[model samples]
Target chain A: MYIADRSGEVIYHPDQQLIYAGLTEESPVADASLSDGIHKEVIDGIPQLVLVKTVGYTGWKLVGVIPVKNLAADIDELQWFGVALLLFTVFLLAFVNTHLSEHISRPLSRLNLAVKAMEAGKENVEFQEEGCEEVQHLAHSIQSMVSTLRHLMDDIIEQEENKRRLEMEVLQSQINPHFLYNTLDSVIWLTENGRYEDATRMVNALGKLFRISLSRGKTVIPLKDELEHVRHYGTIQAIRYKERFEIRITAEPDTEGLYTLKLIVQPILENAIYHGMAAMDEDGEITVHAWRKGGDLYIDVQDNGLGIPGEMLDHLLDESQPLKHSKGSGIGVRNIHRRIQLFFGPEYGLEFFSEPDEGTLVRIHLPALNEEQAAAYQKEGTGYETKA
Target chain B: MKRKHKNLIQLGILAILSLLVILSLFIRDISWPEKAERRVEISVIVRESDSSIWSEARQGMAKAAADYGVELRFLALGESNSVSEQTELIRQEIKNGADGLVVVPAQTEALEVIVKDNPKIPVVTMESSLEGACISVMPDNVWVGEQLAAAIEEDFSEGHVLLVDAAPGSSGIRARLEAAEESLTEKGFTVLRCGADFTVETIEGVDAVIFPEPESAVHALQLLDQNGKTSSLYVAGTEERILAGLEYGVIRGVVAWSGYGVGYQAVEQAASAVLGKELSEPVVESVLVRKEEMYEIENQKILFPIGH
Candidate 1:
């Protein structure tokens, strides 16, 4: 809507001289007054609203204008739709606060690693009592304090294994009277030299080695009756060491029904025949061996002879030292390494590999139990009888 | 905190309903204040200024006075074809303050007493009218002479038709040459009323000449191309020299109108009778063109009167 005239020249505009090329100035509506209303101005920089009037006596005014951002175009489209609904409600509340902190920190981080593995003592502290009820009452009070510290550590380890099985039955009745006084002194020197059939085959191999070292009070046996009691103590030490040492038992047939600790390989085969073949004379050897692996049963023994000296094989199992040439009670390899760590907890025991004269092995270890876990460890007295 | 104060009062009621829908779209885009645009001035009093058909009806009255923002002015009393010099140029355009007149009436019965002595100035008469003119924008001249005598009786059914006749006292070109001489004498075609002469021996044995008048159909196609007359001409009128004599095949058909829609409906009926509105038809249509329907869009808007 325009009409111009006085000296501004644009006789009439009606929308196109480059859309009112800044209303080619009537000095910006020259204080618009021929009388009508609205003035405001600005033009090229936009903000218009003009209106004016007067075309009658042809002084030619008229005006009309408009622009002010087309009157705030609907409040800038409702301020961009309230800033896009406040950024889609802040991205849907950051996706529901990351799914409620991963559903409350994933089971409270698995009950904080089962209470840091029960503060590191770790006796099986399983947790997951599921979450939120105060974290399932703190994982059911740490699984009832790890089941009351594993039933008070299995009642103080079954009263220290009933005082070490009554001190190993008084050290197996003092080793059966020193092995029946060395097998009745080799059967009174072969029945007074008559050599009664080698004194009845050394009294039937010392009556099958004292009926398998007094089996009735069994402390555990079966590796085929512990290799048939070391083959009747190597046939009375090969008729009392006459053949100068060669006891190779080598068991295995699936470790003949497993079980172990009863005079643990006959005190490591009497320390490999009195301290490793008592200073081997000519090719003295002692093998024993036994097998079954991972679930542990291993025996070993080994002994080529005269081996114990890496400074006495570092105190040869140190039962507080006492082994110049221990022939007996020096507590054989620390009492079979404290009865295989008092029954397999110290990861089974005895490792001694020797080397002085190149052979000494003695590996031991234990726990392959079988026969219904050796009759449930001999009715829970931590078991021992397989003397068949 | 009470659901974060009910999410900040529902984001303060969606920011106060988006600022009351942007303050009702800025009060519906600046409410309503701007009205005053009633200028009007219209004076168009032509008989024939420099007649290219009155300069194509003053280019449709200067495009209806630049489309309704009227102030037009055109006065050509056609060099005094004097009816008191076109009644003293409509009394000096109603004393120079014409709120609307649009005349073309050199003598519609002597300008119907100067258009009933300007009954409050809103005149509007074009090719002839004025029993007190307020609307006349003419052109259905007896339906453009009965559609140019039914397009010359579909090309001369019987011969001898030479009807030129419209320049005497122009009673709208003598009522379109008496409706193409009573439709070429009822189609038996022996209607010869000639005035604008075309002589190849006066259109030798005329089978058709009928130039009702676009300047006598360009003076009868320049007297039938200077008398080498190959007769069939039929023009009623749409002058760009009668559409260049129907694009040089020397005019075989045309019964047109729209002298730019009678000068844009005589300045939109003199600006709707000076804004008292209501005049959609005071006679404006007429068609029947033929040099192959002469570029059709309604005969190229009555043969390009300033290209519409």
Candidate 2:
């Protein structure tokens, strides 16, 4: 059964149910059917016209009804076909969804992982770039950005390196002449006090310092020259301290051939003295231990003077800034650390440990070199001998 | 002269007596009304254990045995290639009073001794004929091999031909391969021989491949596929190999002989000999099937009597 209302409302009636149970309510459907200008529905069940304002005078609602048995077969067939079409469309959509997700999600997940790794400061991060244009472009941009960042870091390091060398030059200009002048002042004071042989010995020590320091201005000096340079510096420091600081040099004979960066050991020794001993009163003991261990040349500038506090130990190794509240004015321990890092690598830099007042021990590790310095040390230090 | 003639007479009588003794020993008894219908049993021994050609041959033998009304028993020649089992089977039948035998002998020389023991027993050979058999009915292998060569020459006249066959020591395969080589070479075809086992390795310089029989055609097609290398491969052998090659588009052409016909003819010939009937003339047929023609359903018959 079908029902239609020409009004705005869509009215549906089951004809069999309606006929078996007649319309006992007075709805005026019988009166409007004969006298209305409402056109007949072309097919059953569907509403053909709105009955709200018909051309003929009828109420706002007009109704038409068809029997229930009509069009049932067609409706059932239509429902079945609709369900089949819905299932087929759902299957096709699922297939397309799976395909599209694989294409889009896989590369996106890789990109997400790469970005996460980069954010965590990983150096080498790779991304897959062989998909759609946008993904490929994004990957390419990320790779380019990483490359630029690496290049910028390298530039920053180079600039900081130049600044550090400038500071080292400034320290050297201040300390080298000051040390020479102090040694010359001591020699003058000794000669006026009628200690002529002692003044002559000071002159000899000063000459040895000058010869080892120059070495024709070659940056890499044999272990002997490096040792002699440190010895001369220590001798001058010992005299200035009024013989309160004792200098002991211990080394192996065969290690004279090994080369070290010029002035590396001397600067470390200076840091040990000023930072470890300048406030001391009675006696300051300093020992320079040089030896060859494995393939490396080791030099230790150990002192029994007032040691550095534990909290300030890390500051001694930091190269990003100058040492805070430090009194060694020469191209000090920081310069030595920087030079070792520049020449060999960061791993070969100066390392140290110090307690409150027990002592401070500084160990310098460098690659070993060859025999020419053994002769240079013998010719230079006639009385200076190495323990076998 | 008298002494010599007397001794010759005695020797002739002894020979006749020996013949009589051999006949009595092998002959089985029969019950008859007017004329004695001798119920002589003949055993056919086949070499293979399992094959389609063997099954078809058994079918044909059953049909022929029904037509001739002769009792036929099939004994497997067992797995040994020396025919010792077949010789032992013949000896067992002879002791059991069997009158005649049909044998697919493994070796030609072994058959001579088996036949000599009962000279009058009338041994008919099928597929494998020995020196002493009274009648031999197998595909004339030389003729079949020659037909293959002719078909190949007609199709591909100018390429190097590789002939693949089973073990060359086998009497049947050796004769066929030699004939194929001889016929192919006579027609100016450079014939290269390869054993069935290692045909692929030896197919290096060959242009077209020809195998002697149906059993090894698949292996031949595989070798051709490997050696042909996108070039045209021609196969001449079994229907199964040809069909497979055609299905996979492996071979350009195939030359096959009918296994069923060989089986039918062999049985008919053997049955005719046992029944004292006139033999039907054997027809040897070889056909060249191009890859397209292999699928023509009219030609799908088995082409060898290997089992029966």
Q: Judging by DockQ against the true structure, name the best candidate.
A: 1
Off by over 4 Å in 1: A1-48, A51-388, B1-45, B48-64, B69-79, B82-101, B110-123, B126-129, B135-268, B271-276, B279-308
Task: State interface RMSD in Å for all models.
Answer: 11.4, 45.9
Each candidate: fraction of true contacts kept?
Answer: 0.00, 0.00
DockQ of 1: 0.02
B144-250 per-residue lDDT for model 1 (tens digits)? 87787887788757778777764554567677778778877876778877665445667656777776666656665666677666667777657666777787766
Query: For candidate 1 chain B, which ten residues in a row score worst on lDDT?
Result: B24-33
Q: Which ten residues in a row have the lowest lDDT in candidate 2 chain B?
A: B299-308
Off by over 4 Å in 2: A1-388, B1-40, B77-99, B128-130, B154-157, B167-172, B203-205, B218-242, B246-258, B278-280, B295-308
Compared with the true structure, what per-residue lDDT tens digits does model 2 show for residues A1-388? Answer: 2233443322433221112112112233442343444544433345333222233443334454333355374796566566556655555565566567668866877898899998998878887796678988999998998898788768656745654574457336434666768778998998899978777877787788767876774666777788888888787777667777788988887676677777777777787788777877767888998888887888888999788887678777776656566555456676667666665555687889788788999999886756564445333321111111
Error of 1 at B254 (Å): 46
lDDT of 1 at B165: 65
